[model samples]
Target: MLTTRVVVRGLAGLLAAMAVLVPSAPPASADQVRGSQSRVLRTLGVDAAWRVTRGAGVVVAVLDSGVDPRHHDLAGSVVTGPDLTRGANPRGVRPGRLHGTYMASLIAGHGHGPGRADGVIGVAPAARILSVRVILEDDEPGFRHFNSEARFENVVARGIRYAVDKGADVINMSISKDRPTRQERAAIRYAISKGVVLVAAAGNDGAGKADGPYSYPASLPGVISVAAADRALHKASFSNRNSLVLVAAPGVDVFGAGPGDQYWVGRGTSQATALVSGVAALIKAKYPRMTPALVAQALTSSARRRTARGYDPGMGFGVVNAARALAEAARLAGYRHTASGAGVQDPDLPIAAGGADGRPQLAPVQVVARDTGLVTMYGAVALGAAGCSAGCLVVLIVLVRRARRRREHVMIENPQADRRRRAPT
Candidate 1:
C-alpha cells in the first residue's frame, strides 16, 4: 500500500508537469499528429488573435535561399528579392528551394494552398514577405561552386542594404556557420542602424559544434538569438546550447510549406527563428511607435520564467510567450502613453530639472499640435500698444488746452487789477 501510494503521487506530479509544459494546440487539420498543433500556435486564446491583426502592414525581410514565387501559399506575398548563390546565371536564380521556402512558410506562407491536407499556418499571416536568397544552389556541374573570385561579402551586403532601403521593419536570417566573417558583422550592424529588428537562429548543432562560439548574427550584440524546443518545451536535440541564446520556440516536427507545391514538416533552429521573427512583426504592427529596443525589451521581459532564471546555455530567457509578450506590450504601450502625456505639462511652466535616468521627460514633437492652444500675444500686444499711445497723446493735448483756457479766464477776470498794478510799477 505504501509503495502504491508513492507511485500514484509520482504519476500525478508527472501529469501536472506535462500540463504546464504542453502548449495549446493550433486549429484542427488532417495532417496534425498528437503534438502538431501544440507546436504551431504555442500561444492560444488572446495571443493568437493578437497575432492575426498585429502583423498587418509590417514588412519582414527573410534572408535565406530563394523562395518559390509560384507556390500557392506564397503567391502574391513575396516582394522583390534576389538570389545570392554563387552558381547559376548572371541573374541569381532560385537555389535549392528547401531553406528559403521553409522559412517563408513559417513567416507568411498561406499554408501551401488547397488539397494538401496539412494545415500549416504561419505565425504572422498578414506580414509582407521580402525574400533575399543567400545560399548556394546545385547545378548539372555539381552545384554552382563559389570561386575565390565570387564576392560573398558584396552579395550579402547588398541584400542587407536593399532590405533596409525597402523599409523592412523586421529582418530574419536563418543561416549560420561556424565562422562569421567581419563583413557579415558589418552587414548586421548596418541593418540595425536602419532600425530593422533582426532575429537569427542559434544554430541546429546542439552542444556548440556546428555553431562555433555561438552562431553568427545570434552571437552579435544586438541580434535576437532564438533556439528550438520540442512540444515538452525542452531544448531540442539538435539546437546548440549557448549562453548567447535569447529565446526558444517550437522547432521539432514543425509543419510548413515545402517546394513543388507540397506540405512538409521539419526541425531546425531556422524554424524557431522564423517564429520569433513573426512575433516581432506582430509587435511592430501593433505598436507602431515602439523602437526595436523596446520591442526586444517587451519580449525578454515577458518571457516565461523557468526554474533557471535569467539566460542559460539551453534557454536564454525561456520559451517565447506570445500571450505574455503581447500583454506586456500592451502594458508598455499604456505606460508610454501615460508618460508621454505627463511629460508635456503646461509649457508656461519650466520643465522639471532632474538627472538623466530620473529626469522629467519632455513630450514628443507630436504633442505640440495635439495638446497646445495657440495664444496670439504678438498681435494683441501690437494693437494694445497702439491704442495706449493714442490715448496718452490725446490726454496730453486736452490737458494743455484746459490750462490755456484757465489762464485766459484769469486774465479776463483780473484785467482791471492787472492794469492798475502795471501803471504803478
Candidate 2:
C-alpha cells in the first residue's frame, strides 16, 4: 500500500537549529540497564518467555533516515524506503544518518552474531522496518546536536501517511519537534484512521524549560507517549513526566547498531519510544485480530501502575508488562467471546474496547438483557443459533438409528440356509 515518495526540503535544516543553551545531559546513571534490558524486551518476554511467532506479520515504519538494511541483525527485516532529506542519489540517502539508523536497529535490527559481533539486539527483532529519511542535507553537524531546525513535523506527517499505505501496523516517530504543528496532528489522525498505532518520545528536555505543554506529539491525543527509565526501573532525570505519557522504557545507556557495524549508547526519549513501539509490535503479533484500543488497554492495564491513583499525569498506565499485557489481551478477548455466545446478546459488542479500528469483523455473541435492552436481542439471536444447530444434530442421530434398525431386521430374516437354497436352485 505504500504509494508516494515524500520530498523533504528546507525542514531538513531544522533539526539542528535548537538554541545552544540546552545543557549537555548527564551521563546515564549506573543503575540504568544497558541497552539489553529495554522495556520492549522485558514486557514481551523476549528471551525468557516469548519465542518467535511468525514475527507478528507486522511492519513498523521508522520515520527517520534510511536504515542499514544490511545490518547483521536487520538484513531481512528491512523494507526499502525513500530518502526524504534529499532525492535518492547514486551515492545513497543520508539524513540524520547515524541517529535514524540507530533508532531502527533498536526496534528491529538483527543484531551482532555470536562472540559480541552481532551488536545490540532490537526490542522487536522480528518486526519489519520502513525507514523515511527527513534530516536536512546541509546540516550534518547540527544533526549531531540541537543546532539546526528539523522540518520533522511535516516530514513526519507525510512519512506517517506513507507508512499507513505500506501496511505498517505500528509507527515509531523517534524524532520530536519543539512544538506540534497542525499538519502533524492531522497526519496523526489520518494514520489512526488507517489503523496504525503511533509512538513518540516524551522528550529529553524533562529537567529543562522544555517541560510543560511544550512537548509536541508525546502530549498529543491518540499518541502512545513514552518516557525514559533506568535499569532500576526508575524514571530518567531528563525524561519528562505527565499524564499524557503512556509508559516508560529503558532509555539511558541503551545501545543499538550504528554505522559500519558498530554499536553506540545514548540517553533520550528516542530510545524509550523505540522500545514501546517494539512492545506494540509484539502485541499485534500475538493477537492479529486485536484493535488499537484493546492493545493500548492491555498495555496500560498490565503495567505496574504508578503510586498515584487512576492515570497519573506522570505515567499514563505505568511501566509496560509484556507477559501481563499479552495475558490480559487473551483474557479480555475470551470474556468477550463468552458474553457473545451466551443465550442472550451483548448490545455493547459494537462498542467493545478491542474493536475500535473496525478492521476485523466481530462474531455475533449473545446479548444480555439488561437496562441496555438492545444487547439482549443479539444475545437471543446467538441462543437461537446454538439451539437450532443442536436440534438438527439430534434429528440426524434419530434418522441414522432408524436406518440401522431396518437393516438389522432384514439380515436376521434372511438366514444363511435360505441364501444357500436360493443359490442352488
C-alpha TM-score for every candidate: 0.65, 0.64
| lDDT (C-alpha) at residue 54 in model 1 | 47
Candidate 1: segments with Cα more than 4 A from true spot: 1-35, 43-54, 86-94, 112-118, 137-144, 147-150, 207-212, 334-425
In the range 1-425, model 2's lDDT, one tens digit per residue, is 11111123322111111111112223222223234445446544656425534245879988765677765657778886776544333244334355666778778765544442334566667788988765433335333322223543366667877788888999887765556655577677666655578887776656553343436666677788887776666777767766678887777666665555555566677777887787788777877656666677777888774656756545566777666766787776543221224544232223233555564434656777566576788889999999999999999999999999997887798877557866854
Give a tens-digit lDDT track for model 1, residues 7-66: 010011000001111122333354453136444675422246464364789899987666
Q: Which residue pairs in candidate 1 collide?
A: 138-143
Lowest summed lDDT across 10 adjacent residues in model 1 is found at 1-10
